[model samples]
Target chain A: MMYIIVLAFYLLFTIWSSVKSLKNTESISDFTTGGHRMGLLLGIGTTTATWVSVASVLGVPGYLYSSGVAAIIGWVAGWCLGGALIPLVAYKIRRPETPVRTFPEFIHLRYEPYKQNSPLRMIVGILMTIGYFLLVHIQVVGFGIVFETITGIDYKIAIFAFLIFLLFTSIGGFWSVAATDTLNTVLIVIGVVLGSGAVLAATGGLQNIVDTLSTTTAPTIAGGPPLEQGILLSPLGTFSLSALISIFISNSLGSPASPHWVTRMLAPKNIKVAILQIMGTIGVLLFIMGPLIILGLGAKALLPSLPAGKTTDYIVPLIIQDYAPPLVGAMTLVALCAAAVSTANSMLLTAGTTLYYDVYLGIFSKKVSDKDFNKRLRLIIFVLGFLAVISAIKPPWFLAMGFVYVYGGFGAAFFLAVFLGLYWKRMNAAGAYAGILIGSVGYVVSKAMGASNPFLIAAGISLIGVILAVYTTKKPPIEAYEPYFEEKVSKSTDRVLSSVINRSEGA
Target chain B: MVTALLIWLGTMIFSFVLGTYLCMRIEKSGVKRWGATGKIFKYK
Candidate 1:
């Protein structure tokens, strides 16, 4: 009854917010970026809510339950490092007078503003579409797991609940996403804090849980792999030093360059808002991570072995069901749903807009009125969201590691391309193309070969390719490089950029 | 376990401190390129 009431209230609030935002969403700019005038509260809310996806809630806890403290160093510390580096990207990317709406648009402007037909934008658009589809699917899978566990429903039926997010995204676009995300951030904080407090009460305390785990060799789940003594308390845990380092690099170094984060930087009102948003997210995430760690360790002590047919992904729900008060369980489950919805909407909206704004309009030069464009975008978003729901029905195992693969791929492809484009005056379009192609392909090839450090290997190849191409090719045009480096760009350059935006259908 | 907690807390503190310092530098760079205001609710 509590779950039903809480869910009803959440649904009502989301419907109200989405309708309100849809009324104000007048232009493509409002749909894509809230008119490039987002303030601090909305900025931090959206970023933090998006960052704490189902992967962090379910996957990180599962990792800690099975693999121990290594999850903390690998995932938590690595992401924090990435957050620390985001101000650099924000400062430069938001410097232009008229900020670009999407990451691919930024790429187009930085590398080849003159070439409307550049395939670079198309490539980024395609990759982000595919990647975000998988990401949205991951969140759906999470929702399915939680809902099915709580309600005893079939997974397919439970997964369809994700349509709420799709509806929200389609109606109001970025404004709906930001407004709902603020509410989600509050729910997630309260849920996790309540959960950790319960874990402490149930398991005695943190020290007791640690002492018990340090000496236990029992399997984490029935008929599963054995837990080695002292492993759970160790820093490296079961991971080798190489594996730990790779995880760190893939998450920490890869995250700052990821398109979702870069797009977040562009939406804020100015550079100060952008940088402070990221900083504020880091602060809130730290508070959240502490409780997550406590919950994971306490679960190990409270439920030494999960029953057969349940993976470690079941740990969070299992704990709430057995240990938490009824009201607390209801709220925490609602928070999990919020995490999935907040992230799914962001990814779905990004994928849809990138395809619409960058590929169909910018690359192919297909002209449509603003009304027609917005209408088509809604159709595209609906189709993509439905496809993701189908894909999530059989989501792969180990939710956290799935994100590592995607983040690493993004880092390899865009890290050098984005940072160098922002800072280096001589980095030509050819070099940017080479970096993106070689880095993404190298990362895939290395993964296929089962390389221990695929991200590092791919990143190395990308760097060498970028340098070789940059020195061999002619320098970029003055117009292409001036806005990022100079205090004020030339009038001709400004006109060119303004024209480019106009040509790209006011993107 | 204690070591892991310490490392996690330390990294977050470092991030906050470093982020603040960078924000300060960006603020002092120039007012024309970007403004220094951190408005709580304003949006264009």
Candidate 2:
């Protein structure tokens, strides 16, 4: 009964949320980016929510419990790359000129400097958007598992609750998700922090946990991973030679190319805030993600007698259900739901907006009157919501925890194309295209063909291909240029988000 | 005890719905002159 009521709370809130987005306008920018007036905080929330996803909470920790610290390092490597490294390598990505409403939007602008056909942009955009939704669908499915497990609710009802609650975000795009994230992030911090403490206490304090694992002697969990990927014994060993080399050159080359992160860069209040997003994101990983790794190890001791190689991804919820007093149990459940909803809402709106604005309005129809565009956008969002629910009913092949494969495939391939290509004039479309193609092919094929560590192989192929293509291409002269990636704007209509970018501010 | 939980839950639902509405209102006002397509309401 309590679970049913909790489900009702989320559903009702989500459904009423989108009533306002019914008549949103019909331009590609309008659909893909909520017309991009996102403030700094909202922008951070959008990037964080989408990046965190259900994979972090459910999949990675359990993998860590069994596989050791290697998995945790593997997951954070991309987040660190995407969040921290992008601002440095892709600093010009934060420049003031372009209406970079999405990653594809950047590709469209940057690639057009060489005047290539839209086919490249379209192919990359469509492939990435599909990959994005696939990631979201896995999360929705995972949430369903949690809901059913806690509430004894039917899977169908659970999915219905998940879809309907998340659908509100689609109506107004980031406005609702951002609003909810303010609340959701606060809830998650409290939940994770307290639950971690309780579980730590429930199992006998932190030192007891330390003694139980004997990881003190076993592995450092702190150091830069070793050549053979062994845990280092000393304090200065965190930056293993392999890790420094791999991270500087080849991080995040195989993950899902998050189209939304780049979109939020243009949405920041100032370039400095764009810099802050890097810090905020890494801070979350260090604080939030770091704690999760510790909690999983704690659970290993608490539930040591249960099983030998079973996925302990279910352990967190099991602990809450069995030990937590009702309110704590309810809040723990809410935190998981909050995380799921934040990601779902962002993905649904992004998919709908991308579908409507980028695919439909840009190519098929032109001059979509504001009224028709908004109506269609709402309709598309509703359809996506239903489709996600339908997709959720069928179990996801990628475990919510196992998204590294897809993230690695898409993130690695796409980030290389966008970041390196945008900054280096020498990087041609052929190089960008080759980077994605080789990386995705290398990673996915390596896995399907039975290779160990498919991720590293995919990234290596992508990096080498892009490097070769760039060097082989003719070098455009190093010269002073425009302050931004200036899109061909219809001077008649001002780009709302682009206008906010103050040129006087760019470094 | 049950009543307190119900009230807390009800308050959250109502506030989120209300808060979302207010935020959307401010957004429309802020983006009004900037050629916001949000105004073109076919659904209305």
Candidate 3:
């Protein structure tokens, strides 16, 4: 009965927010970038909410429960560093005088300056769609797990419920996503932080948590992998230093390349707001990671054993069900739903926009009317969202691993194209094409060969490819470089001219 | 145990501070100045 009430409340809140957003949204620009007038507060809220997906809230804690502090060092620290780096590039992204609706569109404009109808744009569009689809699939799986845990519904039924809810919420576009994400950020902070406090109070304190985990031993089974004892207390635990460093690098660098995060960068009203958005995200991370760390360790200390075939991901939900107050548990479940929905909506929206703008419009029907295009975009969202739900029906081996794979792939393929292409003057389309092809292929081959640092290896190959391609090929025409370089000269001239005029007026 | 907690907290704090500082520096460093005016193309 309690679960039903909470679920009803959640549904009502979602519908209300969507309706509000839909009233404000009228065109593709509003749908994709929220009219590019988003202020610092909403920018921060949405970015933080989007960044902290189901993976951070549930999967990371579960990882901490099993493998210990290594998860925190590798995932949390790495993500913080990566998010911080966004401001360095955010200004350039938001500075472009022309509005870019999607990340792939930005890539096409930046790299294929001379070419009409660039294939690189289509390639990026497809890659982004696939990457975000995988991301949404994981979120659907998380939704299923949360629903099953809270409402005693079957996982399959829960996934369909998740799909129906997200389809309605996301139909309003970026306005709906930004508004709901901000609300979700608030709930997430309250639920996770208070829930952690409740757990700590129940388990005595931090010292008790340490004592409990220190004495606990991993269960041993015949013909199974050996379990390491006291891994919870050790810094590196069972992970090697190379593996830890690789995880850190992938997360830190890969985050900005995620299409959803790139879209967030594009939505801010100005460059300063974009920078503040990242800063706000960093601040939010500080609050979230501390509580999650406590929750994971506390769960391990409290629930030391599970039935056969169960995983650590179930530990947090189980703890809330068994120990937390009924109201608190329900709220936490709502927050978990919020986390999953915020990310899934953002991913689905990004995939739909990229496919519609970069692929369908760019390649096929350039003359489509605004009304027809909008309808097509809505149709694409439903189709893509449904496809993600279908794909998630059979959950994968590990939700977190899927995240790492997609993130690493995005980083290896697009990191140079974005980072260097924005800053480096000489990087041309050929160089970008070589880098993406080589980097992505190298990443896959290394992963297939079970390389220790596949992302690093792929990144190195991509970098080398860029250097060789740039030097061997003839330089692009000055027109190709005008937007990035000439813009600098023009802006400085304006500043100098304005300062001189102010001095004369003062005299 | 205390040491571990300190490390985790310290790293998170350091990263946040460092990121904020870099963002402000970049804003002031004239990187933002370059992109304010130029030929901007809207994707068709």
Best by DockQ: 1
TM-score of each: 0.96, 0.75, 0.90
Q: A232, model 2: CA deviation in Å?
A: 14
Best by lDDT: 1
Alpha carbon lDDT of residue A123, candidate 3?
Answer: 90
lDDT of 1: 0.84
Model 2 reproduces a share of the real contacts of 0.00
Better of 2 and 3 by lDDT: 3
Query: Which residue pairs show backbone clashes in model 3?
Result: none
Model 3, which residues run further than 4 Å from truth? A220-227, A485-507, B1-44
lDDT, candidate 3, at B40: 28
Q: Per-residue CA lDDT of candidate 3, range A211-329, in tens?
A: 87777675422233544677777877657988877787888788876667777877887666676667667878778778888888898777776556656666678878877888888
* Best TM-score among the predictions, by candidate number: 1
Q: Which is the winner by DockQ between candidate 1 and candidate 2?
A: 1
DockQ-sorted candidate list, best first: 1, 3, 2
DockQ of each: 0.52, 0.02, 0.19
